[model samples]
Structure formats: C-alpha cells, structure tokens
Target chain A: MQYITSLITATAKPPPDNAAVFSRWFVNHSSWGVLMTVDGQGFPFGNVISSSDGGTGIPYFYLSTLYDPTGMNALKNSKSCFTLSETALGTCGQADPQFPKCAKIALSGDVLRELVSVEEDSKEAAFAEAALFANHPQLSGWPKGHNFTVFKLRLKNIFLVNKLAPARYVPIDDYFKAI
Target chain B: MQYITSLITATAKPPPDNAAVFSRWFVNHSSWGVLMTVDGQGFPFGNVISSSDGGTGIPYFYLSTLYDPTGMNALKNSKSCFTLSETALGTCGQADPQFPKCAKIALSGDVLRELVSVEEDSKEAAFAEAALFANHPQLSGWPKGHNFTVFKLRLKNIFLVNKLAPARYVPIDDYFKAI
Candidate 1:
C-alpha cells in the first residue's frame, strides 16, 4: 500500500488569518501526530501515531486499550492533547521549529473508544474501518490478538501559532466549519 | 538568511539496526520536536520547539520562563519528555508514522536551567551557545527581554523504535558514546 505523507513543507504558508480553514488544512494534510495523555504518575506521556484521516479534522487511531500506555492513560483520564507541527511536513524554510511561522498546533480534548459493541450504528463503524484500512493498509493485517479498537479525539480547544508571536485559540465550532 | 530543511525522505533504509547511531542521527538532523510537561490539570501538554544541534545527542532550548508554559511546568516539576520523528524529516516514504521502521524516539529526562546565574557552567555554557547559534542563528537576535534563556534536558531514559516491536532502551552512556 502506498502512503502519501508530507509535513506542511516550505512553500504553502497559509496566511495567518486566524481562520479554522488553516487549522483544518494543517490537521487534515498531515499523516501523523503525537498523542499525549496523563500517565500513572500524572506526567504527560506522548507517542507518535498514524491517524486515519486528517481531512475530516478528527484524528482516528487503531489502539489496543490493554496494550499501550496511552490507552491505559486515556482509560484512566480522558483528558488529552494532540499536537502537530507544520515543520514536520518540512515547509518552514530556514525558520526554527519554534519559529511562529513554522506552525504548531495543540488540540485539547477527550479521546473516546468507538467499538462495534458500544456504538449506535454499524455503518459508521464500517466507514471508519474502511478509512483506517485505506490510509494505513498495513494496520488491517496486524495480529488479530492485538485487539486494536478505534479511538478518536473529539477536540474542545485549539491553540495555534503560525506566524510571529502570540498564538491563537481557535474555537471548536469555527474549527469544524473551516475543515 | 536561507534554510534548507527536509524530513528524512528517499534515503536508503538504515540497516534495520535498532542501534543508538540511528536514534542519534534522527535527533541531530531534525530541527524541532514536541516537548511535553504536566499541566495544572495533570494532563500532558505538548508544544513544538526548536532544539539546538542534536549532534551532541542532548537537546537544548532557549525558552522564556515568563512566556512558555513548558518553562513554568519545568520550574514546578523538572521532569519532561522530548520526542522527534523521522516522519518529521519527511523520511519513511510510504510507511505510516507509527511504523517501527519509520523511527520515533522519546527521550525522557529532566529539564535543567543553564543560565550563568544558576550554574557555574564556565566552559560548557560557551560550547552550548555556539552550537545553538550555529543551528538556529535567528534565535540569537530575538529580544533579550523575552528572557529566553538556554535550557537542556538531562536524558535519563531513551525509548527508541527503529525496526520492530519491543522498543530499544539506549542508556544515557551508550547514547552519548554513539553520538
């Protein structure tokens, strides 16, 4: 399976419009991001993972609730944060990663499990399954015993810095609309 | 001032060696990473930041105690985690970001204050300043009042995944030696 992935790169400098459109563009085009959750000691633990689709502005994961610490952390405390860097896509030019223009965003929200046993619709599950498989075909063939279930972070707040100083907080409603 | 940066892409795969060399390479070549700390609510908060030359295998940052929450969190509880991804470098080709072969590393350590007032860094301070400026020359010109002082993470544990399951743990000594 072919995976087409790239960070924001150097050319596409979305104007700093404070529009949810740029946030949506950054989130959807990127292939993977770091997921953070509170650990047993109450410390933040972050892990790199692939999302099913950023186009929808919601990130999907194939997680084993019993396998990864992130899952365990989520089960213990649903409050979590997801972060992505436009520099990771390699578009920041000579700018430092922290350079406001390099573009960094953190979405604070709750990560909830969506399984066939708990969800209302079988069709939504199937659609999600197909999306996950299409984006990460290899995940579809992983060991069945891993018991990987799908999870998504429903975002509540967005903190973004795309240029210069002073980061912007994107409202949840505006973010979805822009996407 | 021009910068030429690209995620680790199109290069021949490293020899499936889950060695410290590969991990060090990924860290040094990547310009920025996500730094995580415990928030007031005990949730892990992550922000993207520029790291000085990773060639030494130790990431140094210029942060403002009055500005970034990462600095505030560090002052409260010195422990933190720094993460970098080959995917950020645009490498890994078609592999998903979570793929073991794509290389993701989390360096768990303590964030230390390195100002001349805090420690007697006689020579070490100068070396660090030069390294930081060489890799991130733009940072040197920022307003001094932002109080962006240099800080470095004293690595305690290395969680690296370069090829497959069972992430490798590179000892601090081993990591430095490889660097």
Candidate 2:
C-alpha cells in the first residue's frame, strides 16, 4: 500500500468538519476506489477502478466495456456511486477503516460516458485523456481494442463521514466551488 | 499503510489459478473491504466494513444497524456483495488497481444476520465474536449501545480476477474446502 500512496500528492488534510474542502482533497489525492453499480439482477456490485480528479473535485474514469462489468452495468443503468476510504490513501493511521475519524466519502451519481474520439482531437477528449493518464499512467498503455472510454460521475449527493457524528451531505455546489 | 499490514498474518500467496486457496488466503489475511448493498432507491451503495474469517474461509462481520448504512441496507434487502482488492494487502506492487493480475474478488450473496446472545453462552455467539474481534480488535471496544450484530454472507457466487484472462467463478464448495 505504501507503493500505492507514492503517487498521491502531498495535500494537507482539511479539518474533518470542512466537507467541501475535505471531499475535494480526498478525491484529488485518491487514484483508485470502489465504483458501485446496479447489476442486471439489481444487486449492488462493487468494482475496483482507477480514477483521477485532474485537480477537479469530480472523479473521472478510464473503463472498457469489453472487460469491465462496471462499465457494462453503467451503460444499462447509470445509477452508480463511487466510494473512497482514507485507508486506501494510507492516512487513516491506526483507526479501524470503518471508524468515523478514519474518514470515508461516497459520491453518488449517474455515470455519464463521454463520447470523445481522442484520435479526432476534441478538447473534451484532451481533458479526459489528461485527467486519466496523469494519475493512472498504466491506463494509457491498455490495448486500444479494449475500447476504453472516459466516464465521469454526474454527482448528485456527496456523503462525507469524517467525524464522530452522523455523515454530512456536502451541498453539491460547495463541492465544485472548493479549491 | 505499512501499519495496516502489520496486523495481517504472514500468509503465503497461493498461485493465481488456485482460486480457492488464493481467495481464502486473500480474505483471511485481509481485515476490511467494501460491502455493497442496494439502497432504498435501488442504487448500489458500497460501505467500508471490517471483516474476518477466523481461519474458516467464511467471512463474518460485526455490524451495527444503528451506525452502519451497510447493516441497515442489508436488513431491507439481503442482496449484497463484498469486494476485496489485493492492493489493500500491499501485494499488488505497481500494477494498476484494476489490473487483473493485481487480484480482486467479489463474493455475492444475501447477508444473513445471526441471532447471537453472547451473554447467554451460545456457541454461535462465541464464534461470531471471535471471528470479528480476532481480526479487528478495536471492534470489541466499540460502544455496546451501538447494538452490533454478527452477519455472514450466504455466498452464492465467488468471482476472482487474478490473471490476464476473464475473471473466474470459483465453485462454492471449492472455496469452503480450501485450507
């Protein structure tokens, strides 16, 4: 796991109560997390996927329908959620992963696939490529035949649990506004 | 994350194709992972939870409905999945988290809550208590008022992705039979 965090940029953790800034920092520093999607049977399926924020609070993904159940499931039903634990970032210290102070966040939203042709030179494609490759360099080398596509979460609810109290729902506007 | 692995027992890695041995070794050494459940809105929700097998290869959990959305969601709809990534074990090295060789697993089943009265000297209660607390000692100190219950996945499917090929479905019997 130390190797996993070597790529995480050094970012000071904001106070636990500061949902907007904390959430932004969390996503920015996290490169991978569980992406939950409703399966064809309607059961929740959690899949490990690489992600990057590209300094934006929103998470972007590089997925291939040919190999990923998550991507296939998302195409059928966009309802999805992405979750990250401080455990993954190696910052939870000795706290139990589920411990509130260990910090966890769930970004609930629909997975919107971008129709970007990287070979055709579109700004959207450029942004998507940079967002993913900058953080997940391996993704850039995946077989092109896998038809990996860029997807982003159309966030509707941001759930942050970082303290002893109940989880807080950061206003969606505040999430985007955070530096 | 080095501290996180300190608690993991020194279990030798089973070969990639040995799904049963590998899955068991993976789960036995791992203490926590994402537990996915269908939320009230029928969306998939993944929550981080502590787990243990007590060397039985059957995963067990200590969950409190009063504090865990995963526990509450299980009560409403038993359909669920538990996912673990080798990345958490510090065994994946530099492979992308989604890399097949990094080894990930998902156990899909219904979460069956066990009715155990530890105070009443039930063997089931004793097993459940030891299963979780043995791996997650902090769980024993959690507030008793949280009304934590023991739950187990009634495993129907064992999905393992440990190679370049498509993920494999390990027969349920093989999983339980693995040492």
Candidate 3:
C-alpha cells in the first residue's frame, strides 16, 4: 500500500474514443478506487480501497471482513460497483473530474470472495493475490489476525464517461478483448 | 475543474490523532471523491464527482440530475455516502490507503438538493453555488440544459479511520465545532 504523495502522469493514455482499450488501460494503470457495496441498511456505502486487475480486465481486491464494512457488505449482498477516475491517474489535464472529458468508469457486478482452498479456482486466486501484491506491495505485510481474503468483481456492466457526449457502456466482451 | 496531473502534497495535514479536526480537514482539503447512491434495484452505484465545503464542515456538490445517476438516485432515495481518502491529498506518505493510518472519512446522510427558489434557504444556496464555483471554475460554464443544481449532505454520521485502531464515529456536533 503505497501512498501517492503527488500526482504523476500515466506513461501512456489510451484515446478516449476507444472505450474498450481505454477502460482496460485505466483499470490496469490504476491501483485503487472506490468500492461501493450495499450496507446492512440496504443503503450504498462507498469505501476507498486498493484494487488490481492483473491485466485481465477483472478487478481483484484483498479485503478483511473482520475490520472492513466493504467485505462484510459483500458477504451479505454481492451487488457492488467499483469506480475509477482518470483524475486519479493524473491524465485528465485541466478537466474537472465530473467533466465528461476527464474519463470515469464504474464496473457494476457481484463481488464474490475467492475460495483459495478450492483446487479449481486456487490458481486464479493465487494470480489475483500476486497481482494485488505486485501493484500494492504493502498488502503482503497486512496483519493475519485481520483475516484478509481475496475478492473479485464479477463484472456485469462497464459504464464509462470520457467524451463530451453521453456516457457509454463498454461491452464486457470488448473489455476483456482489449487486454 | 482542475486536473491533478501531478500529485502535490497538501500544504498542511492535521494530526491523525484527532478525529473531529482531522475529519474536517480531510473533507475540506479534498476536491473530489466517490459519491455512492443506491440504484433502483438496490445496488450501490459509485460516481466520481467534485465537491466543496467552503470552509464549512458540510460537503456541497454541483450535480447534473439529467446526466448523472448519482443525483437521480439521491432524488429517489436520499440515503447516500460520500467518501474521501487521504491518499488523494497526497499526504499519506507510503502508507497503504486501506492501512487505516493513511486516514479516510465517510459522510453518511441524506443528500438533499438546495431549493434556490425558496426564500428561507436561498442564501445558503447562493453560498453553496459560490463555494462550488470558487473551487471548480468550469462548473459555472457547464451546459445549462443539463439541469445542474446545488446539492448538500445533511450529514448524519461521520466515520473516520485515521489510526491503526478501530475507526471512530466522530460526534456530529464535534465535527461542526471543528470548523
């Protein structure tokens, strides 16, 4: 978990016109975003959390159910949205974050905890863990007592706003294909 | 609407030891964050949006109800949450954002739009508009047909995680006093 002391421009930015490529590039380059989950009261609860896509266009998170409401909320109701802004990447120029040209994406889906003990998905879980630690090295040293586990967003929708026109929903297939 | 192309450290940061003051400082210094709203189907939808407090403790926003789902959701169900991370301020150093010590604050409340036409709250609405435009100059030039308006969080709870301990719920009164 490295704190960004200053904003730095991304090495490369996919053109905004290319939704699939742009979304993938945005997700791969960004290390964190807001993860929203349904709270106990059935209200929306947004938490700033670290994430990694492992370049697969699928977001993975290392979460602690005991200490974080996000993980707890996911266990009860998997419906969630992971949102990222190009503003965080330092590539939006002078565009306001809410400005259409600034670029923002919301991945809507069910958040399910990865079962590392299961032989079938263990490899994917390991990959996700490696990805998380690779981007967020400090995650490796998180407390074991906190009961951290890997969770992944099963993306059902990819909503992106990058141009001055109305926002577009990037096709899920296209998102994966971009990678 | 300023783009943060380079991360710059916040000029000053409040000591994380104090919950009330720290929360106010965090909220005041941050220009943008993820605003979470419940979708029609009861799923959490997180949007990256700009905000301002105008030195006040309460968060104010300029939103386009015509183009943004967040404002629409708020109109239907006022229950919403606005979250900000110290990492965004570039003041958290090397701490992992999720590492509690980096500091994060979540304001949970009903997001009500200010009725500028009403006589009683018109002054407050005017102040909110001025505060927003002061921070985001481009907001004033946004498309008028978008139906943008001032919205505020009638804060009910302030959740802060600043230390390596359990997060604290700062007393609402103390938060206002901190301003």
Candidate 4:
C-alpha cells in the first residue's frame, strides 16, 4: 500500500497550464469579493460579501437579511456576479493588480438559497452550513432575529485573467475535475 | 509653516468612527474588485478589474477593449458598481471578512469615459492618468493598439459595512470632506 501510494504521488502530477487548476487555486485562496445583483431600481448594486469554497472552489456566502442590501437584492433578483483578485491573496508581489500577470476572476450567475435548515430536504445544505461556520465562525453567534441566509452562486460564466493578453473562459466541468 | 504643520497633525486627527475615512482607506488600499455592469443580455456581468484612486479617493481604471467585457459593457451601459473588501487588505487578522469588523465598501454609479486622454477638455482626466500610472506603473507600458481607455466610476451611492450592524450610507459630500 505504501509503495502504491508513492507510485501515484510520483506520477500523478497536475498539469501546470490547466486553466481550471488556476481558477480554483485563485478562488480557494480568496476570502471575499463584490457580490453584485440588480436592485429594484434596475441599477446594479455590488456589495462586499465574504465567501468560502471549502476547497471545492464553489463560492458560498453568509448574508444578513436585516443589514446587507445584497441579500435584499438577491431575493428580488437572483442574478449576480462575484469577483476576486490574486492581489487579495497577496501573491501578486510587486505586479500591479491591473497587470494581467497578477490574476483575477469573476463568477457570474444566480445567487440562490442553497442551504436552509428549515428546508430539511438537503444534505448539501447541512454540509454547507458546516463549511461556512467552519470558516466564518462569527455567523454562529449572529443575532437570531436578523434572519441570515446561506446562498451560493450558480455560475454560468467563469471569466479569469491570470496572464498577459486576453482572459480565459474556464469550463465548469474542467474546473470541477481539475483537482 | 513647520509649527502649523505640527499643529494640524496634532489637533486635526480624524475620528475613528468616521465612515468616509474608513471607506476611502479601504478602497485606496485595495488594488482590484469586481466591476459590475449590465451586459447586452441585461444580466449583470461582473469582471475582475484593477482600480486605483488618487489621494482624492476617486477611483481610476485602465481597461482593455480587447479583453475585459466590462470595458465594453461600460460603454453600452454606463451604470456600474465597484466593490472592495478589507479582507483583501490582509488587515482583518482573525476576524472573518463577514465579522463586520472587516470593512467593505461599494461605490455605485456610471463608469464613463470621463478620464480618457481623448477628453483633452478635462483637467481631472490629466490628474487621473497621473494617479493611475503612478500607482499602477505596469499600465504605462501596455500595447497601444489594445485601445486601453482610462475610465472612472462617477460615484452616486457610497455604501459601507464596517461594523456589526446595518449598512452605513456615506454621503458624497461627507465622503469628500472626511479629512
């Protein structure tokens, strides 16, 4: 068994040029982004929301119904765009964040309620709650009346800028399979 | 003049609870965000964009017409929102970005060609260019044919979440005056 493990480790190298690997790495390291949704007025409103992927690279959010306009906007319009940067990861070094070499990403789609204990229909919701509370422990202590919701963006477009020249469109399938 | 400088520094310290100062400080320290705009499909599209603000705290951007859909989207629909997170600043320490202690800001409005060099009529454009180039030096060397345009988001709503409560609306005048 030890020999088999060593053999797999030695030969199973991930492709360095894989776009999906890069995308997941960029997002997994990032903790926050501007979550955007259309407001009632049709104006696009972006708000700061902390997100964690539990190493799955799928973004999950903790939103306050009593406070965050993003939560209000999401219930009104489910569509959203979540953005993050390598600069936020602090690995961009001296490169300007605007520099293509510094890397950035946008995940756009509908921000839907994926997890609610009241739903009682989803094991995924239970796992998500565990993942979120693990990363954002403060959520467990938030006031009960504030009515916080756990949401996830169902991404339709994955846009990433990790190098010079044009940005890359990473396929969701490839992204899920990268790791 | 030296004594006057010392007097101002000693007596004119900004209040720690000032939302404007917090907003400006957060954005000024951030290098990139999800710049959201309405795409031709009417779905809100978010793109990763690097933005820098001058000492005056107005954000300026260098965008690629060949790459960022956001730049093109901005031309079609000027209304946009620029979002930033203090977690990106690495100053949140152990505080979850959602902890309310970690400040986040959203500047919403029109992302226009107000600062393009072609607008020779604008002195503000000149300052914006200087500020962007000074802060993001890599931009100065980008290709000429890419038709990179410098743009600015004309701020309409300045929203901030810096504490464990509802969002704070920082007035444009107060945002400008929070020295």
| First chain TM-score for all predictions | 0.85, 0.89, 0.91, 0.85
Per-residue lDDT of candidate 1, residues B26-94 (tens digit):
777777788887767666778997786435667878777777777878888876888888887777888
Model 2 local distance difference test score = 0.81
Candidate 3 per-residue lDDT, tens place, B36-79, comes to: 88988988888888998877777889988997888888899999
State the lDDT of candidate 4 residue by residue for B43-141, as single tens digits: 787776777776566777887666578888888888888887777667777887667777778898888877444445266667667677776777897
Maximum-lDDT candidate: 3
Worst lDDT window (10 residues) for model 4 chain A?
Answer: A1-10
The parts of candidate 2 lying over 4 Å away from their true place are A1-10, A117-122, B1-10, B117-122
lDDT tens digits by residue: candidate 2, A3-113:
122333237877877788888889988888889888888778888888986775768888888778888999999999998989999988899997888988888999878
Write model 3 residue lDDT over A1-179, tens digit each, in one string: 22222222235886789899888888888888989898888778888889987777788999989878889889999999999988888888899888889988999999999887887568778888888897888889788898899999999999899998888999998877774
Worst lDDT run of 10 residues, candidate 1 chain A, spans: A1-10
lDDT (Cα, tens digit) per residue for candidate 1, span A83-121: 898876667787777777788898888987775664463
lDDT-sorted candidate list, best first: 3, 2, 1, 4
Q: List the TM-score for candidate 3's chain B.
A: 0.91
**lDDT, candidate 2, at A71:** 87
For DockQ, candidate 2 versus 3, the one ahead is: 3
